[model samples]
Target: MKENVFYGKGMGPVKKDYPDIYEAIVGLNDAVYTGKALDYKTQKLIALAIAASNSDDRAVKKQISSVVETFDTSKDEIMDVLRIVLLTSGMPPFVKAVNLLYEVID
Candidate 1:
């Protein structure tokens, strides 16, 4: 029932059961993806960073895979985001993200 937020697919029953919530979530996604202050790639990296900070493996992998596939995002650029996590979220989450990153990118 959980949608892949990146592709705008996989809404499952949410579209039929909770139309309002689904629309709001879709709207929020649109708002976040708008290129106002940060560019799209930068925003995606931040999203990956947030996933890392939360230690959410599914989200972390999804974001990582999406970035790698969608953009010409470099390994170093991905590391740059993880490096920020190392500073703010500390070693655990940073390590988790880095490990997952290797799995996804490799």
Candidate 2:
């Protein structure tokens, strides 16, 4: 059985089951932070949008926490970014992101 990446609740079997692939992705994420392509605030906003677009609630929550800690962005600004993501990525994903944000921010 695969451990859940999201809530500690049970999830089924792993899909990829490839440790090397996971490591590569982790490495790439670290690489992205090596150069300051964008300011921390902008990156946080982008991460929020991307998580929303991908309908990844865990990532949305994580990114929201990062934004709150790193940039000290207000909740309103985070909501605004989520709204923009909704405008582009549609309602369902936006709703998921909003729910995740609420769970984290609360």
> For every model shown, what is its TM-score relative to the native structure?
0.86, 0.67
lDDT of 2 by residue, 26-70 (tens): 566566554377765786588679988999777788788877876
| RMSD (Å) of each candidate, 1 decimal | 4.0, 6.2
How badly does each model clash, as a count of residue pairs? 0, 0
Candidate 1 RMSD computed on C-alpha atoms after optimal superposition onto the true structure:
4.0
For model 2 the TM-score comes to: 0.67
Cα distance off (Å), candidate 2, residue 93:
0.8
lDDT scores in order: 0.84, 0.72
Report lDDT (Cα) of residue 96, candidate 1: 94
The 10-residue segment with the lowest total lDDT in model 2: 1-10
lDDT of 1 by residue, 2-48 (tens): 23354434575777788898888788888768878987888889989
